[model samples]
Target: MAPPNLPFRLIRPAPDPVLAEAVLRLLETPEPASEALAELAMRDAPFTLALLSMRPLQPGEATTLKRALTERIDEAGDALLRAWLMHTGSQQLQADAVGQLNMRAGQVAETAMHLAIELRYPRPDEAYLAGLWHHVGALSLLASTRDFPVLRDQPATALERRQAERQRFGIDQIQLAAWLAESCGLPPTLRDALALAGAHEEHVAGAHPLARILRAAIHIAGPDATLDEAARLTGLDTERLSNLKTDVDYLSTEGLKSLGIGAPGAAEHERKPSGYPMLPSGWRAVALGGLLAGAFEGIDGKRLSLRLGNAFRLLFGKTPPLMLTVTEGQVQPLPMDTAQVAPHLITELGLQVDDDTSVVALALRTQASTSHFPGGDGPGRSTRDWHLARWLGTAGILCVPWQIEDTPGVAVVGLDEHLDLPTEEQQLMARLVSGAARALAAERTRRRAMDQLGETLMASQREHIRRVTHEIKSPLTVIKSYLGVIGQRHPEDPTLATELNQVSQEIDRVGRLLGQLAHPESATEEPRSTSVSGVVQELQHVYGEPLFGQRNRELEIRIPGGLPPVAIPASTLKQVLLNLVRNAAEALPEGHRLTISSPGVLITDGRHSLELELADNGPGIPEPRLHHLFEAAESSKGGEHQGLGLSIVKDLLGQFGSYIFCRTHPERGTRFNLFIPLAKPA
Candidate 1:
């Protein structure tokens, strides 16, 4: 079955200089540099008005023409179609508006290129290239004039046009734009802005390239605004008013004057070469210009976003001045370009800021920072900018730095608000920042611990003194009471007196334990004589108890023949030896032989001394528990032993500028080696 041939109506001969010349000039530099593409699109934003007044195309013809245009180019038809639809209002029409969109896009692109060349916004070729598609919908709208009566005549007032559009078709041009945007798979930013273009009530949105270029291009072209109320409602200030009044008339009357061939007035704009890099031209403008007073917001480093669809929109369609609102705490990752930004309703989403430090900062840190962490696949980070430029899917991210409660560091958080995407570097930075916050929290915790420890120490000392006093007094009281009772009641019984004697013995034992506990040095004062050999012998006799030994263990104490013990305090040495032996016994396994080995343990303070070592074959202590194994009260915390054992050993040993510790092993056994002074004829 052959398709029916469609009717062909000759497009009216356009305004001699105004129509044909503009299109011809647009065709001059069709291929511009990439950076200039955005500026070109912006300059040609009002492409719909131009095509409407210049070349009127029917929906069918426009569709065919659009197919021809894109097919002529070596790009994917689907990609071109999608990109165009996203930026245009063409989808609102029953048939295709491709032809009108294509033609107007080409013209606008060319004109914007020329404007870019004049303005000096980097590469004019690229700007003009993008300018071509600045108004796909506008051209589409103009092309469909034969089918839709709503667009029959250009209204005198903006409100009248809006009302007429709503009455006739239940939607304004913006809705058409949104329809096209959705059909083309445009970025959310573009789709949203296009949908709200004519929705005055919803104008609190950010200024995206879709809106900025569309409206700005119209203003650049012959502006058809006639209503004062419309101006007030749209918030068109005096500067915009004057620019529209002058630029519009100039473009309309002069037919693209000098084509910006050599105009110094247009030289201020920056240009860019056509290549994949950090940002598009509009973003460059934002970075340099700071904000769009026309759009009314300061969109800086925080509100920047790059959308590939928007790039196409700016390159091949008309757009409007975008409105943007940005706050610091709100941040998101742009799916199209994989850029990071804060919460924003933007008109011109172009400001691109390059932060290199942010890259390394997130890379080195990947720890948790918050108590409640939302689960995700992994951290977000990217070393290469292009890896993040996948336009396959839509994703959103929000990152905010927060100090974790009771934690030491600040944390950055990434969110997929709609779960559209899970960006990389954007997430990583958030996590890294969070880790730092946790570190800060940890430091704070340590400080608080130290303060509490000091307070505890003070209170503990008073309690210990009180307990010691009571212990000392209680023994004396019992002895005195026993004596009194024996003299009064046991006067006629010898057996009663013997019972009293046993009571006295118990009281003496308590008194001895208390004395040892209270004054470590007061038990027995040993003469200050450095007798290393005698010290070893005394230690062996004291620790020779069999009850403390393991079932299969043999406790052996040996002093090699070459050893010399010249000077030492007998009591302190005894205490140190006793502590080591006790610890060794505790650590030894049942039925295992324990040997105290003193290898060549060196001791020197610019002088010679003795070396003693006690090595046993038993289970070795774990490495993690080694550092604090001899910190007095902390050694036996896991066991039912008073922490004072190692504490007394260390304290007595410190006074002699010497120390004693044993290296314990697992497979072979434990060894306690000590270095005692061996002076020669001192």
Candidate 2:
């Protein structure tokens, strides 16, 4: 069947992954896949023979054949069968041939099972199924070639006939079918059978289990073949074959018993039939109680205690006694010999085992101050056993952890009902007892460093607050006294009256000392959602009392009406406008234009959530202090400011997530942008 350019091979090589994948997609169409294979078969005589050889099987057996094909494809995990079969027969894999081949396959399986069972193979059923399907390729070829006169007629010998057929054609049917299984990635057992079909010396030398199975099926299906002789070839006793045959037949038709699979999930509802020991009555309580007390402390006591009680009921078949230890920190387990540990335990107050109990080991790894435990009310001699027992009595179980704070290195928690200790816990206790010896020493090293740092910062803040307070207050007292003297002398004199008024103003100027207190919040509000145009109109009347008159200032409004609202609070917007414009008023030799605008707000220029810009014509904002303007007490060169106003503006804007920044150049008046988030609906 090779093309002119193609080299001679028993079967074509392979199909493309893309074409194979596409074939699976095509399979979903209602058109019959078997029809496709049959059509391909018609065009290729040899392939046609192989395809037809698989039909005419019983219905149940046909289903099994379909399962076998699925098994083959799954094991292959290939997406290319589509392309490979296109030249051969894609439809051969479907239902038309599925039923007959599947039934024949089951018959093969039944025969193999019988043969293997008679042989006493441990896995008789598996051996039978494997044996039955071993030479599917050869069987398919034999069936398809049967319609040919020479092939259908009796041959002097099966092997001789096969060789004769091969000589006449480039390859025989068996060879071609065998090649097909290999190309399709059939399981090893079936693949080997393709090589062994003729009972050739090299191909059938050792008679693999599958080959033996095929030999038995041949005997069962061929009346002339003797069952005893065939059974002997498979290492099976003829007497047992019939029974195995019945069982295999039943399995093929009725299915394997689910319980016999021996997997756990399959047996979940059934009690284990055998194999186990009588578990110790209180091992869980004994083990878990120590771990719980050491790890969680008093809060877990009730839950852990309940768990222990339930464990006791399970083990004893009745509820039994269990112990619990409740302490603020860890309930340690200590054996009787822990008194020798106090001196070392003073440091590192953490969970640890004590020298006494071999079963209970420390479990919690807490982060806490590990200062050496202080000596008790007074140190006095006490027997180690009595002391440890008292700890056990008080804490419920005896335990030891290095000093948690300034406490005993070990405390007793509880005794488990198991009344036995684990070897590991005993070792942990030894390590704890050893570590206690130096725990306190480490605490002393850390304690010294902390004490020195605390003393230094405390003294520094004290002196700084004191020195500054006195320096500022002295002049204030003198100013108040001078004002008082002037008032008494002037009574009604114009000169003295003017002098007194100046003193009062000086006091107010000095009172800006409040900025030194860092009260950024105390500064009045900033410009907010207040009407930009209306505010400009009312400015003169509102501030008439303090103005040298908006006189020299040229007020300009860049704001457009009906603009989207800003986030500014009305009161704060007014206050901020007053301070900025007032500062601008103070800066100019005379009045200058003030301009405000409506524009998109930009964030990220500063940390403010929203920003608005206010502009003025007075000598541009100084470059050096532009960024620092928001810092307390900052000032522009040659321009004196109380400094708190801008700082306070920054702080008040912070409340509503708004901010202001200025863009200014020598020729251009400063433009201060005020930004705020568009407010969300309440």
Q: How accurate locally is residue 612 in candidate 1, as Cα lDDT from 0 to 100?
A: 69
Give the top-scoring candidate (lDDT): 2
Tens digits of per-residue lDDT for model 1 on 1-682? 1111112211111111122223333334555232232222233433332222212223333223333232222221122222222222211232223322333444444444434444444444334423443444444444444534345356557667756656654555555545544443344544454454454533522454334333333334322443343233335564555554455344532433333221212232321111112344345333322211111122222211212212212322211101111223212222212233222321132222232323212321222221111224333343221112111111212323333553222222222133222232223233333333343334446668989999999678756965876767686877768676766775888755655565464455456556666655567654555555566654554345542442456667666655655456765676677676777677777766666556654657655656666676767777776666677545443657876776677777777766666576568766655555555564
Residue 608 in candidate 1, Cα distance off native in Å? 1.6
lDDT of 1: 0.41
TM-scores for every predicted model: 0.27, 0.28
